[model samples]
Target: MPSLGLKGADLMCAAPTSLTLVMTDMRLSFPSDEELLSAIRGHHIGDQPLCGFAREFGILHEQLLETAAAHAEIARRRDELAVEVDTWVAARLPVPHPNASLHTETVGRLLDRIAEAQVHAYRLLMTISPDDPRVHAAWYRLAELVDGYTDLTREVIQRARRLPALGDRR
Candidate 1:
């Protein structure tokens, strides 16, 4: 879908028409837990993040939240991580957004946008003098939290992905 102020089919005109185009144009496929962690760490500030952002594209399959009779852990961890990430990010916001206006974003984009804010926080800390222990401490804590997020997300990908072995039983 187009973003706010984006008009017509042009929404994706600038965006690549396929995954291959995205990988070739910016080489930012998630492809692994490490890359996602790097994104969470705010390392990719250029077209890479936009491309890496593409990694998030098809990763949020509903199967990732599957809760079968045999695999209760899938559901449990998904719910746990969802709440944990949301609560942790909410707590870190410098100030809450006042407007509750409607949005057209997909769930993945919403999550990505929040993660971007966390990255922005790191950006702010980086600009501060390193001599200041206070900001560095906060930055360290944020990094740790982002690591935790990466772990949870990786687990979701590993166990919850709808492999052929898993089938469509759920």
Candidate 2:
């Protein structure tokens, strides 16, 4: 009866037999990628070469970088479109007069801006998870704005269309 020197309360009494079983079970378990690499490199559990693990890690790291870059580009596009829409909306808001002609121009411009914003937002939504409620809300708002602008533009265009030509038609 050799003392295995396993010191841990009740387990210490059953140490020798339990330790053997545990070691056997652990040896039978599947080795991790690192372990496999170490084995391949002629190193057991101690100091191992791990060249294979290094290669695999490198490949995964590169893929992660590529994914990050793509996501960044998408974010950049969304930001650019948002800024453009904001600028267009701001411009349309403060025009000197609320006349039919001005209204028509403003609405037309706003509609165009809304259309662009919708496209960008849609692209972003496609990339993001559908469960994101904020994106859905923003999309709805964009749609409403586009519709409103379009309706306004149509009314103005109709009114302006009915008016006689501005130039002297003598």
Candidate 3:
């Protein structure tokens, strides 16, 4: 009778100079085509496959192209959103004094604060549902921050404009 303890064969290929021992613990796994395709799909970015082998299968061409197109569409949408956000911010914020570094720095800090508030609002929205009361509150807080920054920036720019040049006589 065959030994019941033996689940698989211990493969060994011997050479004159060296010997390689293969065991069950060191078994190699070749994933199925479906599994490979699925993995490739899951991790692909910006129209490029994470794994080079994703292009090996002929059947995967159409699927890969479709996935790449989807990624490209997502990228395009993100770019559009970025442009919209910049335009929105520019519309709301006061322009800093051209020759005043202090005015620019003050405005820069206010912008940073606004960006932080926006990030907080975004995170809250992501964590909670759109209809949640907290989501609305977060958005309100972000708007208030921006409004406050706008008021403060206007004051700073006005103050900077009123300051006379250092070498000028009164």
Please list the C-alpha lDDT of all candidates, in the order they appear: 0.36, 0.36, 0.36
Quote each prediction's TM-score: 0.32, 0.31, 0.31
The candidate 1 region of ten consecutive residues with least summed lDDT is 161-170
Per model, state how many residue pairs clash.
Answer: 0, 0, 0
90-136 per-residue lDDT for model 2 (tens digits) = 33232223454533233213423444445445555877887788678
Candidate 3's residue-wise lDDT over 1-170, tens digit each?
A: 11112122211111222111223444112222233233223322111111122222211323333465665654443333334323433333333457544322232233333444555566677778989998898778867865664444344434332222222221
Candidate 1 residue lDDT tens string, 1-170: 11222234322222222122122223212223334434344333223333234223212222332324534554454344444333432232222134322223222333443454454444556677766786666657656654544443333333331111111122
Model 2: clashing residue pairs?
none
Once fitted onto the true fold, the runs of candidate 3 whose alpha carbons sit more than 4 angstroms away are 1-108, 160-170
The better candidate by lDDT, 1 or 3, is 3
User: 145 in model 3: Cα distance from truth in Å?
Assistant: 0.9
